[model samples]
Target: MSIDAPYATLDPDRVLDAVTACGLWPDGRLLALNSYENRVWQVGLEETSPVIAKFYRPHRWSDAAILEEHAFAQELAEAEIPVVAPLPFGGRTLLHHDGFRYALTPRRGGRAPSLESTEQLEWLGRLIARIHSIGARQPFEHRGRLDRATLIAKPMQAVLSSTLLPSSLHAAYRAAAERVDRAVADRFEAVGPIRQLRLHGDCHPGNVLWTDAGPHFVDLDDARMGPAVQDLWMLANDEKAMSALLDGYQQMRDFDFGELALMPALRAMRQLHYAGWIAERWHDPAFPAAFPFAGEARWWEQHIADLHELSEELT
Candidate 1:
């Protein structure tokens, strides 16, 4: 018979066992957090502070790539940047248990940052500028780069080959996806050679946490080398908000305003990649339940229309 499921193997007992192996006593408390790419839990300790355990998805990343992610977090912490870095246990950052590679980090609690406040937006801008400054200092050897091939081509191929797209919509999706792909390529070419640096990769609002002290970044799992704009554009909801962010960014470092032109193309690529990501992970039990919209025909129709709209803007 087939196995139960992918994450079903990661039972509470296994989660606790993973923590106990690290020389910590669990208090029988485990809360599954909001993560789909990986299994993350907040385990309460007997006497010590609680910690968040992130179990890597099987075969998702190699040891070297995971180490590079840890190294980047450690580097940011050393620079006095407020980032949730993985705690070193027994002089090691990554530990393997029951065929799962995991890392432990101290628990950090905070609400989402207030994007509406100019002060808050500027604060984040300054923090991101510092991150980019350090990111430009070095490069990742093992991790992948965020480019057209990884974001567009691979995702397009995956969607076309998979049964995720209904037969009726396949032609429309293919045509729109190809148009968006070409538009993205042309936009990148028009922008010319932009600086590529080690980035937090996914810098949306959910990834940032706000406290009385300030904002601190969490979850560098998606960390990779990409343009500075990739990190900045997602946070901005409008031109005024973007200007406010740039106002602060320019204070700490030189802002490349030309990157603004690539925003439309970047947004289109992310939209295309998201569908492919869901389709690729559809076999996972969590995907269908979590993303119910992906199962419907209307959603795919809207997606095609959105793609065409994005393509129009890119042209």
Candidate 2:
């Protein structure tokens, strides 16, 4: 059958059936959660509390890679970190049904963490530090890295290959992107060799939920090996905020100050990767509906201009 939507294969009935297969009796109520990369649902149970069921995007990750992420989250939980880990079902964390891979976790409900609060930022910083401590303990055997090849090269290739990019904007985009790529490489070179460790990979404010106890990290879908600053930079907005976060971070672990110099390069890489991600996923019906701007020639023009500006900033 042809796929019309990203979750075309993930019907509500299939999700409930998957939960039932895990020995959890579903109450026939399924609430689809906010997610673009994967299909997540809050499945109501008959006797127990509702559980969050996440069906991984097909072909996005290998079985071993997803299992590695589960192992990392389990490690953090074992250390008493406030991270939502996958609940093992039938002696395994990863399960397969109807050609989809998924994992079940107890529902965690909380509002977004207040990034504006110094106290809250500090608390989060400490928690992230503790997570980094465990992340540094070992390397992922199956997972990938956050470096030039993955961040810049592969993404650039994807954008060039995708039909989403307007032909009129191709020359400008290629010129700007190549310049940005070079600048990124140069910035990384100037920073010299920095330490890389397993990180939360995507530590934006949305991934964190705050409550009375503290903040708990939820998605490990992007977890991989990368510079520690990769996790820290996304949390802070300005110098003052970064200082506040580092204050708490230092209390728990020593951070390499040199990594600060690499932030611009990382930002440029993220910009490129994000565009490529949208272009690559444009075939999924959700992408067009959610990111309609990407289809416009003016948007590509502006995107190319932004790339040029990033290259200038890097220079």
In candidate 1, which residue ranges exceed 4 Å CA deviation? 1-4
Q: Count the backbone clashes (under 3 Å) in each candidate.
A: 0, 0
Candidate 2 local lDDT, 1-315, one digit each (tens): 234465786889899999999988999988999888888999999988999999988878999999999999999999999999999986899998888889999999888887788998898889889999999998988889998898888888888998989877788888988999899899888889887788999999999998887889999999989888898888899988888889898889999999998888888889989999988888888889899999898888888888888888888
Clashing pairs in 1: none
Candidate 1 local lDDT, 1-315, one digit each (tens): 112255777899999999999999999999999998999999999988899999988777899999999999999999999999999988999998987889999999999988899999999999899999989999999889998898889888888887778999999999999999999999999999988899999999999999899999999999999889888989999998898888888888897888899899889999999998888878788888999999898999999999999999998
Q: What is the lDDT of residue 245 in candidate 2?
A: 87
lDDT of 2 at 251: 89
Question: How many clashing pairs in candidate 1?
Answer: 0
